[model samples]
Target: MGTLTSILVLSFLIFFHELGHFLAARFFGVHVEVFSIGFGKKVFSKVVGNTQYCLSLIPLGGYVQMKGQDDMDPTKVSYDQDSYNTKAPWKRIIILFAGPFANFLLAFLLFIAVGSMGVNKYAPIIGKISENSPAFEAGIQENDRIVMINGVLIEAWEDVSTHIQESVGKLELKIERAGSVQTLIITPKINEYQNMFGEIKQKKMIGIAPSGKMIEVSYSADKVIGFAYDQTIKATTLILTSLQKLVEGVVSPKELGGIISIVQVTSEASEAGIVALFALTALISVNLGVLNLLPIPALDGGHIMFNAYELITKKAPSERVLTSMTTAGWLLLLSLMALSIFNDIYRLTNGN
Candidate 1:
C-alpha cells in the first residue's frame, strides 16, 4: 500500500510538470504531439484534441512532446506555423521553463497547505548543556525555557541556534525556570561539529540541545503566504547547496539515492500522517524543480540555454552540435541514475 501511494504521488508530480509544458505550448499556438506520464513503451493512451496523453511503462519520469521539439532526436524539425520550431526563441525558452516553474509553484502551494495544517517545531526548552560549556557555566539548567536571546524573542529551538550563531561577543539570554524568569550572560565559543552531510564545520555555539518537546505552530492567513514563500525558497536553496557540495566533494556520491530511496522515504512519510507526507512531497517537488533547471542537455534548462543562445546570436545551434550534445546529456543522465541505484542497493544490503 505504501509503495502504491509513493507511485501515485510520483505520477501526480510528473503529470503536473508535463501539464505546465502542455499548457504553455498550447498558449503559444504550438502543437503538442504527446503528453506522457512516463518514458518508454506506452501502456495506456488517449487522443485528446491534437495531443495524445499517455501512461508509459516506466514511472521514473515524463515528458511533453511538442511538435518539432524532440529531446530524443534534436535533429527532428518541423517549420510549420503551429510547430515549436517556428516559435520565437524567447517563446521557446518560456515553454521550456514552464515545466520546472510548475513544480516550484506546486511546492509553494503544498507548503502553504502544510503551514495551515500546523507545522511542528521544537520548543526552545533546554534539554542538556555540555559540561563547562558557556550555557552550563552561565547557570542554565535542563527544562529551562529560552525566552529571548540578545533582545530577539525566541519562539523555537531553531531561533535559539540562529541567535547563538549570529551573536557577536556576549549573548543576553532570558529564560523561564520554575515559573520564574531570569537573565544570564554567556559568551559562545567556536566549536567544531559534524553537519548533516558528515562534514566537520566550525561554528559559534553555546552547547545547548533541545528537550525534544514539540509545539504545533499555525500561521494566520496573511502569515501563511509568507511562510510558504519562505519555506519554498529555503528548500530550493538547500537543494542547490547540496548539489554544490556534491560537486565540490564535500559530500560523497556514495550517499546518492535513486528512485528506490525516494519510494522508501515517501512510503514512510505516508505512514507518519498527512502533515509528514505533505512536507516530504513539497521538498521533493522543489528538488524536481531545481534539478530540472540544471544546464545539461536533455533537460528543460539545457533547452532554455540553447534557445537563449539563439535569442542572443540570432541563429540556432547547428544540427550536428545539437544532436551530439543531446546524446551526451542522455548518456550522462543514464550513468548517474545507474550509480545512484547501485548506491541505494548497497546501502540496503549493508544496512547503512
Candidate 2:
C-alpha cells in the first residue's frame, strides 16, 4: 500500500508541475502540441481541441510540448502564429517560469493547510553528545537548548542538522541551559556517513543528537499563514545551504539521491499517516522548484538564461550551441541518476 501510494504521489507532483506549463502556455496564446504526464511510450492519450493530453509509460517526470519550442528538434514541428517561439520574450519567460512557480505555490498551500491542523515540531535541544566528539569537547551537554549557529537563529532541531552538516571546520554555537545563555566554539569532526540510500558522504559532525521531545503546534486561523511561510523558507534555506556545501567540497556527491531514494522515502513517509505524507510532498515540491531553477541546460533555468541573453543581445543562441549544451545536460543528469540507483542498490544489499 505504501509503495503504491508513493508512486501515485510522485506522479501527481510531476503531473502538477507539467500542468502549470500547459496552462501558462495556453493562457499566453502559445500553441501546445502535447501535454504529457510522463515520457517514452504513451499509455493513454486523448485529443482535446488542438492539444493531445497523454500519460506515458515512464512516471519519473513529465513535460509540456509547445509548438516550435522543442529543444531537441525545434524545426521538426510546424507552429502556428501563436506557437511558443513566435511569442514575445516576456511571454516565453513566464511560460518557462510557471512550472517551478507552481511547485512552490503547491508547497505553500500544503504547509498552510497542515499548519492550521497542528504540526509536530522539535526544539533545538541536545539529548546526547558522543564522548570525545567535537560537541562533547565544546561542552555541549544534554538539556542545552541551542539558540543560534554562527549568528543564525536556531528555531528547531532541523536547523542544527543543516548547519552542522554543511560546516567545513569551525563553528560557533549558542545554547541556553537553566535560563542562562552561553556561547561555545566548536570544530566539527570531519567524517564520512553512509546515508539511507547507501551513498557515502563526507560531512562535518558534532556527534550530538537532537532532544527527543516533540511538540504539536496548532496554529490559529490568523497565524497559520505566517507559520506556513516560515516553514517553507526554512526548508528552502536548508536545501540551498546543503547544495552550497556540495559545490564547495564540504560534502560529497554521493550524498545526492535519485529515483530510488525518492521512492524509498515516499513509501516510508506514507506509513506515517496523511500528515507526514503531506509534509514530504511539500518538501519534494520545494526541492523540485529550486532544482529546476538551476542554470543548467535542459532545465527551466537554462532556458531562462538563454532567453535572458537573447533579450539583452537581441540574438538567440545558435541551434548548434543549444544542441550541444542540452546534450551535455542530459548526459550529466543521466549519469547522476545512474549513480544514485547504484547507491540505492548497494544500501539495500549491504546494510548502510
Candidate 3:
C-alpha cells in the first residue's frame, strides 16, 4: 500500500509539472501535441482537443510536447503561427520555465498544509551537557528547560542552536527548573562538529543537547504563509547547496539514490503519518524544481538558455549544434540515472 501511494504521489507531481508547461503553452497560442506522464511506451492515451494526454510505461519522469518543440528530435520544426517555433523567444522561455515554477508552487502549498496540520519540533529542554563544557561549567543541568537566550525567547531546540551560534561572547540563558526560573551566564567555546553533509567544521557551541521531547506546533493563518515561504526557500537552498557540493566532489556520488530510494523513503514517510508524508513530499517537490532548472540540454533550463540566447542575438542556434547538444544531454541524464539506481540497489542489498 505504501509503495502504491508513493507511485501515485510521484505521478501527481509529474502531472502538475507538465500541466505548468501545457497551460503556459496554451496561453501563448502555441499548440501542444502531447502531454505525457512518463517516457517510452504509452500504456494509456486519450486525445483531448489538440493534445494527446498519455500515461507511459516508465513512471520516472514526464514531459510536455509542444508543437515544433521536440526535445527528442530538434530537426522537427514548424513555422505555423500556432507552433512553438513561431513564438517569440521570450515567450518560449516563459513556457519552458513554467514547469519548474509549478513544482516550486506546489512545494510551497504542501509546506503550508504541513504547517497547518502541525509541525513537530524538539522542546528547548536540555538533555545532556558535555563535561567541562561551557553549559556544564555554568551549572546547567539536565531536565532544565531553556526559556530564553540573550533576552530572546527560545521556543524550540532549533532556536537554542541559532542563539548559541550567533552569540558574540557570553550568553545569558534563562531556564526553568522545578517550576522555578533562574538565569545563568556561560561563555561559548569554539568546538568541532560534523555537519549534515559529513563535513567537519568549527563553530561556537555550548555543548548542550535536546532532551528528545517533541511538541506539535500549529501556525496561525498569517504565520502559516510565512512558514510555508520560509520552508520552501530553505528547501530550495539546501538542494542547490547539496548539488554544488556533489559537483565539487565534497559529497561522494555513491551517496546518490534513484527512483527506488525515493519510493522506499516515501513509503516510510507515509507510515509515519500525514505530517511526515507532507514534509517529504514538499522536499521532493523542491528537489524536482531545482533539478529541472539545471543548465543541461534537453531540460527546461537548457531550453530556456537557448531561447534567451536567441532573444539576445536575434538568431536561433544552428540545427547541428541543437541536435548534438540535445543528444549529449540525454546521454548524460541516462548515465546519472543508471549510477543512482546502482547506488540504490547497493544500499538495499547492504541494508544501508
Candidate 4:
C-alpha cells in the first residue's frame, strides 16, 4: 500500500510537469507531436488533434515534442502560423520557461496551504545539552536562544540544522542568554550513527536538543503567497548547493538516494498525517522542479539556455551540437542513476 501510494504521488508530480510544457506549447500555437506521461515503449496512446498523447511503459520521465524542436524540417511543417521557431524570441522564451515556472507555481500553492494551516516551529531555545559534546565544549548553555550561526540569522530550528549539518568544524554562533547576546565558537564533532534511513552517516553533532511550539499566526493573503514563493526559491538554492558540494567531492555518494529511499521517506511522511505529508510533497515537488531546471543538456534549462543564445546571437545552435550535448547529458544522467541504485543495493545488502 505504501509503495502504491508513493508511485501515485510521484506520477502526479511527473504529470503536472509534462502538462506544463504541453499547455505552454499549445498556447504558443506550436504543434506538439507527442505528449507522453512516461518514457519507453508506449503502453497506451491516442492521436488527438495534432498530438499523439501516450502513457509509456516506464514511469520515469515524460516529454512534449514540438514541431521544429530538432530542426526546421520543411517536411513536418504544416504551417508557419504558430510554429515554435516562428514565434518571437520572448514568446519562445516564455514557452520554454513555463514548465519550470509551473512546477514553482505548484510548489508555491502547496506551501501557502501548508503555511495557512500554521507550521509547527521548533524554537531556538536549547532544551538539553550533552555532556562532553561539542555544545558543552563550546559553552552553549541550556535555555540559550541561538540567534545566528557564522553570522547567518537563524529563523527556525531548521536553520540551525542546515547550518550545523553543512558547516565544517568550528563555527561561530550568536546566542541570547539572560537578555545579553554573546558569541560562542563550536566545532561539530563527527559521530558515526545510523540515520533514520538506516544508513550510517557521519553526522555533525552540537549536542543541543530542540523544543517545539505550535502557534497559529495569521498572515495576509499576499504574505501567504509570498512565503510560498520564497520557500520554493530557498529550497532550490539549497538543493543546488548540495549538488555543487557533491560534485566537488565534499559530500559522500552514500548521501545520494534512489526510488527506494524516496518511498521510504514518503511512507514515513504519510504516517505523520496530512500536514507532514503535504509538506514532504511540496519539498519533493520543488526538488523535482529544481533538478529539471539544471543547465544540463536534455533539460528545460538547457533548452532555455539555447533559446537565450539564439536571441542574443540571432542564430540557432546547430542541430548536431544540441544532439551531441543531449546524448552526453543522457549518458551522465544514466551513470548517476546507476551509481545511486548501486548505492541503494549495497546499503540494503549490508543491512545499513
Q: What lDDT does the true structure give each of the candidates?
A: 0.92, 0.85, 0.93, 0.79
Tens digits of lDDT, candidate 1, 82-137: 99989999999888889889999999999999999999999999998899998888
Which stretch of 10 consecutive residues in model 2 shows the poorest summed lDDT? 71-80
Off by over 4 Å in 1: none
Off by over 4 Å in 2: 74-79, 123-211
Cα lDDT tens digits, model 4, 1-352, are 7677777777778888878878888887888888888778999999998789899997766777787665322133233775777777777778877887777778888889887876777877787898999899888887889999999988678778889988976889999999999999888887888744344778788888885543344346768887787778888877887887778877788788887777778888888776677778888888888877888776777777777888999997886787777778778778888888888888889888
Candidate 2: the clashing residue pairs are none
> Model 3 over residues 128-240: C-alpha lDDT tens digits?
88999989889999999999999998878988988888889899999999999999999999989998998999999988899999988898998999999999999999999
Query: How far off is residue 327 in model 3, in Å?
Result: 1.2
Winner of 1 and 2 under TM-score: 1
Ranking by TM-score: 3, 1, 2, 4
Q: Give the TM-score of candidate 3.
A: 0.96
Pairs that collide in candidate 1 are none
> Model 4, residue 292: what's the lDDT?
79
TM-score, one value per model: 0.96, 0.77, 0.96, 0.73
RMSD of 1: 1.5
